[model samples]
Target chain A: MTGIEPLAVAAAGLMGIGLYGFCLCRHAVRRLLSINLFGNGVFLALILIARRLPDGPDPVPHAMVLTGIVIAVSATAFGLALVRRQARTRGDDET
Target chain B: MTALDSLLALLLLLLAARCVSARSLLQAIVAFIVLGLLLALSWVRLEAPDLALAEAAIGAGLLGVLLLGTWRSLPLGHGNERIPLPWQGLRPALITTGCTVLAVLLTVALHQHPEQAAMSGLAALDQLDAAGVDQPVTAVLLNFRAYDTLLEMGVLLMALIGTLMLDSPLPRDTELPARTMLPATLAQLFLPLILLIGLYLVWAGAYSPGGAFQGGAVLAGAGVLLILTGFGEGDGRDGWVLRALLAGGALVFTLAGLLLIPVTGAFMAYPQGLVTPIMVLIEFSLALSIALSLLLLYTGTPGLRRRGER
Candidate 1:
């Protein structure tokens, strides 16, 4: 029974905390932050797996994570834009 | 080293908990930003310098600015109100149990370490000399899986378009209550160096731990700094040139892959002697488009103008 890697434990902890936040937090921005945290956890896990290959660190997963990071940022930006638009519309309707 | 890793792990979890549960929105945002920086550090420790660079620039730096800006624009006390959780008593206990079980499963699966049939990393290493890039990650991205990279550019472009369609520019404070010369002076000092480093990162990707994505994010950081200091602002008009810069990366990538089919008899396959130059051209164009796209997203506008420009 080998001990689990510390970083791997951290990665799992992040996912759990993110899940808890995403479920409990009511604010859109907070939920988004939780989602991003969840994403960071997944990326960390993939990176750790990449380190486990026999020869050296795997380049394929590295490339994939890079692509994933850019996509995640873009997606989050778009979501933030939606949040802003929703708030504005709600304000307009109230007035 | 193990002890240090354990400490970092503990710190990361603690910060993440704080980010989600902090009473003030500002405190939560600050905690998230610090968490991102720490994640970058962990990436470095794990031997992924390229990921570290990208995570710091894009994940922490750019995203932090965007989040803070959005927070500013939201109605006062928007996120501060504590809405009672659904099924408050049973839900939290259930959620905790579920998440804990999931984590244990993931850890156990990772330990299993199944054998892979075709080890892509080893294969990429074997063909490094012919891949036209000394960096294996670069080789994988621009050569072996070039199609995926091209599609990613399309995804980025579409995301920008969607954000534009939202038509919600972050509300800006037009008048600075205490306008100072320090920020502008600092921006002036650092802009050239930032630009140089960004371009160098793109060039260095062929043989080192830098590439279009990381380089573009750094360049976008430069744009962010300018805007923060009032040297740059979003303009209402969308010029033809701005459109071109935004779309050029995918256009060039698609055209390169299509046109080379006749010469190499396979899509995206660069001829042997011309691989390096072709990759360099593609990389720089990608970097340019990416940098501009990210900058536009940050500004939440269609076009950009320097301060005091008519």
Candidate 2:
């Protein structure tokens, strides 16, 4: 209700939801989605936590998240490519 | 928190949940794109404009197209098909419970981490002048921890290589979409502006809320739009030039680092007086490489030649 609890709570909730979805999803593409959700959740937590500190904010974590975002997308693209290859080779629908 | 923050947070949570739980894959994919946009807004609220820009351009724009394109390439009706529900048992319930508990515990712990200890990154901000970039994040990324940035570029190249290795060639759907006058006209007008903006973002990164990642994403978005609208086409052929752009960032950074060793003693030290020019060169190459890699990745091909009879 006060300070930055709401933001933190939202981040924590997203993380939990993403983790739950990661566990529940059966499809590779869906799993990639879940994992990215989880990553954004962590990014949200990190950026906000950096703000909570007395000093203005931390550039290191900010930089990390920035780097992480790009890397996450690249990895996602690659994973999707793999999934497509598997589907082609197996001659079956994605599970 | 202001009402706006609360509202944004609620919207984000809802979209995230929707993306995760939607009954259809297409529905989930759409929700994911919206979630990404909302995340950009959230980043803005958190006072991180750089992040907001990157999230909007890369997270929402490029990634959204990537997801939808993948879905389109998949067999029709795959998105609508209903697969079996979560693992048929107690595992689902247990995972939900476990994650929930973990979340609660971490939230409680977040309150206890010492505030001043988090000052190290901010403290490093004091030494930003030597980095030759006015932006603190830029300094950290390009100077203080250039090694990490170099490795990050390597990760991107690795991903590109991995995608290429597992590349599944599209079924020769070379037919361009019927060219509509309005969108085509608009794209012709917009492409130049987007290209200008991407370059501007990279240039402004030294002193403001823009950088190579954000700029490259914007450039890639432009390329994606071009491919999607049939204003441009992807030849999907391999060549040395495409490979160079794909590996250029990592190669330039690594080679520069090694070359500087005898002069600066430290691996990634930008040397003493030549920091500015070197940083500029590195940023330019990195931006160029990132743009090409992202664009190629979206094209879902190892190489992209502008569409032609060749």
Alpha carbon lDDT of each predicted model: 0.87, 0.79
Candidate 2 Cα deviation (angstroms), residue A23: 0.8
Report the lDDT tens digits of candidate 1 across residue range B155-188.
8898889889988987776885222768888988
- What are the runs in model 1 whose C-alpha is more than 4 Å off? B81-88, B116-118, B177-179
Candidate with best lDDT: 1
Model 2, B1-310: lDDT tens digits are 5687788878878887887788788888898889888888888778788988998888778878778777767776654534333455677667767987987876776656663566567677778878899987888888888899999999888888777777664333456553565666778889999999999999888889998888888888888777666665555577898778778888888989999999999889877789988888888889999998888777667777554546
Clashing pairs in 2: none
Off by over 4 Å in 2: A1-4, A53-55, A92-95, B79-89, B169-181
Every prediction: chain A TM-score:
0.92, 0.84
Supply candidate 1's per-residue lDDT for B184: 80
